[model samples]
Target: MLAALVPLPVILPLLGAGIALMLPGRRRLQTAVTVITLVVVLIISLALLFGVDALGTQVVAVGGWDLPYGIALVADRLSALMLVVSSIVTLLVLINAVGQEMADTANETPVSVFNPTYLILCAGVANAFLAGDLFNLYVGFEMLLGASYVLLTLGSTAERIRAGVTYVVISLVSSLIFLMAIGFILAATGTVNIAQLSSRLAELPPDIQLILHVALLIGFGIKAAVFPLSFWLPDSYPTAPAPVTAVFAGLLTKVGIYAIIRTETVIFSESDLRIPLLVVAGLTLLVGILGAIAQTEIKRLLSFTLVSHIGYMLFGVAMGTVEGLTAAIFYTAHHIVVQTALFLAIGLVEQRAGVTSMRRLGGIAVLAPGLSLLFFIPALNLAGIPPFSGFIGKVALFQSGFETGDWLIYVLIGAGALTSLLTLYVIGKAWNLAFWRDPDDVEEPTAELVEEFEERREALAAGKAWKAKPSVPRTMSLSAGAMVGVSVFVTVFAGPLWDVSSRAGENLRSPQTYVNEVIGHGDGS
Candidate 1:
């Protein structure tokens, strides 16, 4: 029965989501259930973080079925750490949603129903983390994505709907590509189970294996928003409700990165994918961040940043070494936390400013000093400034790149440095406009307050004077608090967390320990 705990991370959220709907619609009751369930899931994730074998993997067979036929849940270091990070980000985002009566950005929808939907999303993410087979991974992706469809379009405004349709369509196509890739894999190898396929993959001819690898790469690359397949991301992400946007920033693309890592390191052990990933990674970083440099909207800038950083993780996977993979894993974990916090902080800015464009916004420091600081810290961390988690992650990644001793890798490192600087410059440009600039820098003809006052005065002339409300968002305070808290946690505990990430990377590259443990090798207790 204890062994059955392998499935709990996935099942817990699914179970809790059902129970949440069963509860009465009282806000307090719903919040309690969501908080408690998420907390429990977080605890399980942390337990796995500590208890899972650093060098081994664990698997649980459902319904007592044998390996090939039964559904299995596997947890190695990488999945456990991902589960922990995902659970933490989900809880923090959920808390931010509940604390502020989180409203839809485009419209005024309430936050009550968001609880159940968010839990479903968490469950789907957990399933993806724990799934032991290719088909099950697809099921997890679909489950999580169906939840995402709701999250992305929660408010039902016209722009949101338009953006949501693009998001949904792009997502579905990626899934279809993934399914097609899996079909090819199953056709060639005759099994969809990862453990089963692990043995069988080596039996296939090298050329056929490379084709399957390329197929998987293309499909997952689209999901990761890798270069040439990344255009849909910036368009859709900016319009989502704030918390939904935050979670998407944190979790969604990383799932694609996780799949890419798993396929390159585990299912397809050949070094064949390295040079291709090297090329993809370099291009992804250059193209995505360059797109960011061209953006004026704060949210849009972060969206491009998300696409850009995926390249760092890809860099790790492409090196195909323990140092490289571990560094990549570390970078992935750090970026997930940092990215989620950054988006959430930006959500606060949008909430208060009532607009996302830096051109139309200013004087946040005057009105929201706390929030300005919150935004500033994460923005700096994201640009890889020192003493923050992002710098540490980037250093680890850069080390791996240099160790490869490839000139292209060095050039990629130099390019990564340039991208970091550009990222800082773009974010700095936003900061200057929104916080540092004089009011005279307004893009429009008049300051917002002045314009609003004039409109009110004109209305008064027509006897229609209603006092104008300030643009500050109600959830603004909570969003800042959540993101700031995450940044602090990452900052304060960098050492232990880095160690955990290192062990996770080690587990991923040489999966024999994981496979042997999952199959209950001769060391059976």
Candidate 2:
């Protein structure tokens, strides 16, 4: 029964997608199926978390095949916790998307493409989280990538098409690099199973090991949007539909981070990559938030902030200690919730104000206090204000860093502090411009923005523009509020969640715990 539960999270979503695809014209059926699928997934995810806590890791080898020979699915505390959080976010995003579809002409046809594509995307995320081998993980990445290309280019606007093209090219390059790395790993270690590789990789020569490590890092770094490899993210994410952008912002890069964590802790635990990773983390944080400060548009500013905050997770990863990794896990979960809420709230802002450029938005506080509150709470949480989960997560990382007492760690710590303050300043800047200032005080767009808007308006007048002026749906507001509520719930329940994260960290630091569960302690004990 425990084995049965392990693969259900991935399988259920795929099954739902297939069913939804078969009922293309039945929007109500599609909605029911998607909602039922995710609710079941959430329940199973929670059960898996508790099951792992009580019974240790649960592993299922598909088709009754034995260790390292079959496609394996394992649910430990980390994966289960991530599954639960991600499932919640995906479910809410689906609700938000449904609201959007009902409000937009994009889904006015008898058959809508959004439902199946979204289910596939969720399936991919589930598979990535539960996969026990590198090849399965790669397959998961491709599934999500394929779905995302569709989502990114949905409604087919000129800007979206351009952004999607750039996104696809970069993703394909990264996937190719990742696939090549897998081939190298299989050649060097003779297996792509993470458990088997963990044992075998430790025996390879230092130079061969370093080569594989570098290859994997480069592949995953681009997906994770680590500094220098992250220039494409800000451009690609901002143009997608809001719910799509919210989910992508919250989950996609974290999937990359998850892969990195598995590689560092499970496969190449002894690899000498700490200093380089630390340098990347410090640079990502400083450079990312600095870019955020320079942005006049809310979406673009948040995008830069997204890149900048990835540095914190990398910082925890670079620490390579149990406490540090625990903090990373906690922060990853917290940021997923907070970041998605912020984007959804901002989506509401754009819906109400007709633009995301701060220079053109004002009087929102007086017009829509609910929207302002939704944005305000998450903004503060993202900036690491006290009593919020963001602050709790960062505090954990800071404590872990100080315990190390290294000069370099200290420098990174200071950088983190500075980044947090700057993040607050930038978010506050957006709030002041978009909400507090009187409408008459709002500035005009630059000549370039004016020209672009003029062109879009002309196209709309000529019936050539893809986007219609959106009417803000009540469901949209509710969906965004639901997400914000989740973030707040994290703050309220930090103690228990932190304890779970600590346990996850301890388990991760010892790779053998994972290996023993998957392979079963030598010949089924």
Candidate 3:
């Protein structure tokens, strides 16, 4: 019965996307289908999470073919948890997008394009999490990337088009690398099935294994926006519409991180790449936060911070211990919710103020206290303030590092601490400039800024799109608020969630369990 449900998370969204595309003219009906599909996916994910916990790993061989030849959909504790969180984030972002459309007649985002593409994106995410083979995972990445390309260029504005081009080129390069890695794995081990790779990979020459492992990391690292390879992200992500940006910020890189976790724990369990990963993690932490400190635009600032926090997850992966993996899982979950919430809150700021540049904004805390609270909670949470899930996850990671007692891990602990402090500083600076200072005190808009704003307004007016006045839509506000509430929920239930993460981490450490469940008790070959 449980195996029957494993594919629904991927299947239902694709079905809904098809339905939504068929009824493009019927926005209400399209929205209803999207929402109902996601809600069901969420419910199914929750069921899978509990079911996996109680029943152990659940595997489904597509079309009833046995593994090593057939596609497999496996849901264990980690994948199920990711499904649930991704479902929640996507659903809320959809609502926020819908609300933005309803409230603003001048909105450039087309519901016809957004809804179907968004559903396809969700399906791809689910597919990646539940994928049981390397080739299947590549297919999942393409699904999401195809949908994202359409979503990213929704406005067709010059800036968006330019950013989308850069995004697509970078993504394509990464995809090419990933495909090559898959080819190499298939050629070397004669199997791309993850379960079989667990055993077969170990038999190959050490140098060959190292080459394959590095190739996979480079591919996944670019997608995750780890520093030195993350230059595309800050430029690409901030150009999209608010809801699109929110979801992209929240889920896309995390999927890459999830893939990295799988590669480290499941396929190359005995590889000794810990020191290199640690060095990369330290660089990622420092460089990402330093970039954030230099940004003046709210979205761009958050984007850099997003890259910065990926290091924390990578830090856990580098530790290569059960405790470390547990913390990484917890931090990944925390960052997803908090980062999405922050982006959504920034969306509200953009809607109400018509700009996200800190230099052109002020007095929000006094004028829009509700919006202020919406931004504040998530901002603090993202900054790793105490009593929030961010703090809990970070502390867990630091504690795990301490337990390792490696001198290099000790240096990483210092880097993580500095990253947290800088994160707090940047968030506070944004709040002061955008919210606390009086609007009257803000510097006059530059001539170029004035021209850009007027051109945008004139374009909308010329297109018969300038109907609604600038104000936060009720639905948009509510959606953002609900996302904040979800972040808080993570904090409130940190104990239970940590337990689940611990269990998931344990499973990851013992890859043989994953192998045994998927392909029976013998060696996965």
Candidate 4:
């Protein structure tokens, strides 16, 4: 019975995508279908999360085949938790997109492509979380990648086209690398089933195991935007529309982080790579936030901070302790909501104000007190401010690292703290420039645009007909506010979530339970 529910999260969204495609001419109908599909998935995902908590792991072997022969969809504690978070974020972003489209005419935009492609992208993300085999996971990645290409280039502007090309080329290269690693794993272990590989990989020579581990890490690291491999992200993501950027910023890289967590714990638990990961974590932290400090554009600054926070998760994961794993899981889910909310709030800023460039924008706090609240809360939360989930999550990781008592771990801890301070500094700088300062005090980034807006306002006030950009849409503010609400909810309910993370960490550290549930047996000791 539980197995029957395991596939619905993935299946419903794909079905929704097909249905959405037929209603492009009827956009309201398409959006209704998309919303209904996601809402159902969200309900199912929540059930799965609780269901797994009570009954342990649930597996659906497609077409009734068994073991390594079947395509399996497994929902354990970690995957189920991720499914719930991802579903919520996607639904919220969908709401944000609908609000965006409602503010403009369909002929002036591309609603036709956006609706179905968005659903497809949601399905792909769901599939990636629940995938139980390497090949199925690849299929999930491609599904989302294809949808992302469509979403990224939706406006068809030259800037969007250039960014989309960079995004696609990097994605394809990453896919190729992932595929080659899959081939190597198949040759070494004779199967791509993750559950089966848990045992088979243990039989390979030590050097071969190390090689395969590094290969998989490199493939996933690029997707996760770990420093050095993350150059494509800041360029590719910001060019997309606001809702798209929000979702990508929040969920996509975390999927890669999810893959890394799965690989490290389940496949390479005994491997000797913790020290190298610690170094990577430190570098990722310092390098990423430093880049953020140098940015003048709001979106680019957030992008860099997004990369920087990945180090906190890596810091937790690299420790390889149950406490470390717990912190990583908590932080992953926490950052997902916080980061998405920040992006959505920034989107609201871009709509309410004419520009996101710190050099040009000001007086937003005086203009929209509500928008100021929305941006400020998430910005502070991202900086690990107290009473918020970010602070709680970071503290957990710091405790985990401190327990290790290693000099390298200690140094990484210091770097993490410094990175947090720098995150606050940069985001504070953005807030001060974009909201607190008077508009006239700064040079207008786009002088002509500002002049035109001023003239239009003057004309309207003088009873003359003048076209002006529409006010921020109600739905957009509502959707972004919903994310802010969710972030607050995270803070309010941190204890329960922390408990869930602890249990998930326990399960991840002990792969035998996952193996037994998925494959119905484990390798003999």
For each candidate in turn, the TM-score is 0.91, 0.93, 0.94, 0.95
- Can you write out model 2's per-residue Cα lDDT over 328-431, one digit (the tens) per residue? 99999999999999999988887776689998877667567778999999999999999999999999899999999899999999999999999999998999
What are the lDDT scores of the predictions, listed in order? 0.79, 0.88, 0.91, 0.88
- Give the Cα-based TM-score of candidate 1 against the true structure: 0.91
- Candidate 1 residue pairs in clash (backbone atoms < 3 Å): none
lDDT of 3 by residue, 288-384 (tens): 9999999999999999999999999999999999999999999999999999999999999888878899988876785578898999999999999
lDDT for model 2, please: 0.88
lDDT of 1 by residue, 1-525 (tens): 335567888888888778777764566677778889999999988777677744356677766777756676888788988998899889888877764465332243344457677888999898888888888898888988998888788778899899999989998898998999899988887778776666678888888888887888888888888998999999998898777788898889999999888888778764366777888898888898999989888889899999998988898888888888887887888888888887877777676666778777776665567778888888888888998878888888888888878998898898788888888888889889877775555674235535554665678798984553545444545655766676778778988877877777777777666555555522221
Off by over 4 Å in 4: 102-109, 445-470, 521-525
Instruction: Return the TM-score for candidate 4, rounded to 2 decimals.
Output: 0.95
Which candidate tops lDDT?
A: 3
TM-score of 2: 0.93
The all-Cα superposition gives candidate 2 an RMSD in Å to the true structure of 5.9
Q: Candidate 4 lDDT, tens digit per residue, 1-525? A: 777899998889889888877766787888899899999999999999999999899988886676668888999999999999999999999999889883134532465678778888988998899999999999899999899998888778899999999999999998899999999999988899998788889888999999999988988999999978888999998988899999999999999999999888987777768988899989999999999999999999999999999999988989999999999999999999999999999898888766788988876775677888999998999999998999999999999988888999999989999999999999899989888986667676456336655776688799998654446889999999999999999999999999999999999999988888887822222
**lDDT value, candidate 4, whole model:** 0.88
